[model samples]
Target: MMRLIFAAMSGALFGAGLLISGMTDPARVQGWLDIFGDWDPTLGFVMAGAILPMAVAWRIAARRAVSFTGRALPTPPNPVIDRNLVTGAVLFGLGWGIAGLCPGPAMASLGFGGLPFAVFFLSMAAGMILFGLWNRR
Candidate 1:
C-alpha cells in the first residue's frame, strides 16, 4: 500500500538524515549539551535544518483534514505543565545527559555501538515497560 511505502520512505529518510547529520554519534549529542565545556555547534545546524521542514509540515497540517498518507491528523496533546510532565522531562534530560543517547539516536547507533548500546537499549526498554505497568496500575 502507498501508506506503508510512504512510512518506510519517511523512516529511511529520517534515519539517513540522522546518520548524515552526525546525530547518530553520542559524542556529538553530548558535546552539544556541554554548553559550558567544549560546546559543538554542528548539532544546532542539524536541528535548524530539521525544524525548517517540520515548520512547513505543521503549517500544512493546520490547514489539512487528512494527512498526506490518507489518515486523519491526530489531535495535539493538551499543553498543560503538570508535575508528571515536569518529572518526566527532568528524568529524560538526566538520562540523555548521562548516557548521551536519546531514543532515536540510540536505536540508530545500535549496530556500531556494540555492548554499551545494547545495555542502554535494554535498560531503556525495561524502564518503558515498568513505567507502562506502573501507569496502568
Candidate 2:
C-alpha cells in the first residue's frame, strides 16, 4: 500500500513537472527537434533541469543499500551499447520525431482528451505488449 502510494505520488510529481515545463506541448517538442529549420532550445534547458537532479540522485542512491521504503535500490543500468540498445534508441527516436510525443509525454497528453493522443497511447501500449510477448520467447 505504501509502495502504491509512493508510486502515485511520484507519477503525479512527474506529470506536474511535464505540464509545468511545457513538455506537454507536442509542437514545442517537434520544434526542439527541428534543427535544420527553426529549432527550439528550450528542450535543452529542460533536459539539463532533469539531468542535474538525477545525477545527484544517482550519487545518493549509489551510497544507499535500500530506499526510504525499505526496498532494495535498483542497480544502475548497464552502459554497454549493444544491438538491442541501438535498435530501441532508433525506434524511440523515430516515434518521437514522427509524433513529437515519446511515451512519458504521450501518457501525460491523454488527460487532454484528444483522438490523436488516444490513438498514439493505445498503439504504444499495444507495441509494449507485443514486445513483452516477443521477448519472453
Candidate 3:
C-alpha cells in the first residue's frame, strides 16, 4: 500500500513536470528533433534539467543500502553497448522521431484531447504487450 502510494505520487509529479515543461506538446518535441530544419534547443535544456538531478540521485543511491521507502534498490545500469541495446535504441528513436512522443510523454499527454496521442498511447501499450509475449517465447 505504501509502495503504491509512493508510485502514484511519483507518477503525478512526473506528469506535472512534463506538463509544466511543455514536453506534453508534440510539436515542441518534433521541433527539437528537426535539426536540419528549424530545430528547437529547449529539449536540450529539459534534458539537462532531468539528467543533472538523476546523476545526483544515482550517486546518492550508490551509497544507500535501501530506498527511502525501505525497498531494496536495483543494481546499477548495464554499461554494455551490445547489439540488442543499439537496435532497441534505434527503434525507439525512430518511433520518437515519427510520433514526437515517447512512452512517458505519451502517457502524460493522454489527459489532453488528441486522437493522435490516443492512438500513440494505445499502440505503445500494445507494443509493450507484444514484446512481453515475444520475449517469453
Candidate 4:
C-alpha cells in the first residue's frame, strides 16, 4: 500500500515537473531541436537539471541492495553497442525530431493536449505494438 502510494506520488511529481519545465509543449521541444534556425537551449538546460538529481539517485541506488519499496534493485545497463541499439536510437531520435514529443512528455501532455495528443498517443501505441510483433518474430 505504501509502495503503491509512493509510486503514484512519484509519477505525479514527474508529470508536474514535465509540465512546469515546458517539456509538455511540443513547440518548445521542436524549438530546442532546431539548431540551425531559431534554436532554443531550454531543452538542454532542462536535461542538465534532470541529470543532476538522477545522477545522485543513481549513486544512491548503486549503494542499495534493494529499493525502499523492498524490491530488488535493477541491474546495471548492458555495455554492448549492437546494431539493434543503434537502430533503435536512430528511430527514436527521428521520431522525437519529427514529432517533438518524447514518450514521457507525450503521455503527460495527453491531459491538457486535446485531439492532437490523443492522435499522437494512438499512433505511438500502434508503433509500439508493431515493433513488438516484429521483434517477436
Q: Highest lDDT: give the candidate number.
A: 4
Global fold similarity of model 1 (TM-score): 0.92
Cα-based lDDT for every prediction: 0.89, 0.90, 0.91, 0.92
What's the ranking of the predictions by lDDT, best on top? Answer: 4, 3, 2, 1
Better of 1 and 3 by TM-score: 3
* All candidates: TM-score: 0.92, 0.94, 0.93, 0.95
Clash totals in order: 0, 0, 0, 0
Cα-based lDDT at residue 126, candidate 1? 96
The digit string of per-residue lDDT tens for model 2 on 1-137 reads 99999999999999988988878888999999999999999999999999999999989889999998899998778788899989999999998888888888888889894999899999999999999999999
Clashing pairs in 2: none
Which window of ten consecutive residues has the lowest lDDT sum in model 4? 67-76
Alpha-carbon runs more than 4 Å astray in model 3: none
Candidate 3 lDDT over 1-137, as tens digits, reads 99999899999999998888778888889999999999999999889999998899999999999999899999877887899889999999999998788889999989884898899999999999999999999
Candidate 2 whole-model C-alpha lDDT, 0 to 1: 0.90
**The best candidate in terms of TM-score:** 4
Deviation in Å, model 4, residue 100 alpha carbon: 0.9
